[model samples]
Target: MLTVALPKGALLKDSIRLLQSVGLDFSAFLDSGNRQLQIQDPTQTAQGLLVRAQDVPVYVEYGQAQLGIVGFDVLQEKKPQVAQFADLGFGHCRMSVAVPSQSPYRSAMELPPNCRVASKFVHCAHDFFSKIDLPVEIIPLYGSVELGPITGMSEAIVDLVSTGRTLKENGLIELDCLYDSTARLIAHPLSYRLNQYNLEHWLNEISKNSQPLAAKAS
Candidate 1:
């Protein structure tokens, strides 16, 4: 059976909706009382694995899931060896550098070299700084990275910014945006190359039903 890995947070609704458009219903994951992490589609066409957005690529890369849906940011950070099929065009956001509102630094480049930068996305943060030739400590903060700057533990934070509400409420300002992120379809390279479980057809149907990769969701 073809197994799909589904992310568990904000992207869940749109992801399930997209899958439904392709005739695979995995909406059980949306139930208010649904405790099951693994569910088979009612039509028994495929199965869904509910997992953290960050782990979606892990499952697909290891072949635990033949196909998966995840955010582009996670893919950029993880760099998992999986075939990126298409951008599903939802879950729009950006990874940005933020600092306390009163901080002297006006941009990522303005921050002093060797300063501490905190983030849950350490890899993305590192890559961004490396390209700019800034030598800084990338502190890995899995929870509440804004606290790094708030508590004076770090000079800035690299994190996802949606509507900028959280940043505003915390008195943090965006210094620079590393990249915009959207949900994407992914498949195990070997499985995709071999068309295992007739995966190519399903992937094609999904792409056909989704908006063009360049079309952002409003």
Candidate 2:
């Protein structure tokens, strides 16, 4: 049976919805009290593995899972051996560099050499700063990165920003956007080669249904 890895959290519901649209049902895993990590979807001849978003690509790249749904942010950091099949287009956000609203550093380039920035995504932060020729000290923070700038722990932060409410509440403002991120469908290259027919069919089905929703004009 085919095995798929799915991120466990806010993206889970949307991931399941997309899979269900392509005839894979994982409603059982959605129950509040359901703690099953592996769920069998008999109707679709597949199994689902619930995993952390950061670990999804690892599972797929190692051939443990034939496919996975994960964020672009994780992919940028990991760069695992997987074929990025389709952009699921949901879970939209931006990876950005943010600083305290009151700071004199208005842009990423305005920072003095060797300034510090905090983030859970250390690799991403490093790459972004390097591209702009900004020498930075990367302080890795697991959570509440917004506080990095507010509390003077770091000069800025590189993190995922959706609504900007968190930054506003923490007295921070985005200095520069690193990348636009969304959930993507990825497959192990070997698995795709081994199960070409089935994998191709699945990819086509998902791509067909995953088109961006049209904007309603005012």
Write candidate 1's Cα lDDT for 1-218 as tens digits: 99999998989999999899889999989889999999999999999999999999999999999999999999999999999998898889999999999999998999999999999999999999999999999999889898998889999999999999999999999999999998999999999989999999999999888875347565
- Say what the RMSD of model 2 is: 2.0
lDDT of 2 by residue, 79-170 (tens): 78899987777888889989888889888999878988999999999998889888899999999998887778899999999889999998
Q: Root-mean-square deviation of each candidate, in angstroms?
A: 1.3, 2.0
lDDT score, candidate 1, position 196: 93
* Total backbone collisions, model 1: 0
Which regions in candidate 2 have their CA more than 4 angstroms from the true location? 212-218
Model 2 — TM-score against the truth?
0.95
lDDT, candidates in the order shown: 0.94, 0.87
Structure candidate 1, residue pairs in collision = none
Model 2 worst lDDT window (10 residues): 209-218
- Which run of 10 residues does model 1 get worst, by summed lDDT? 209-218
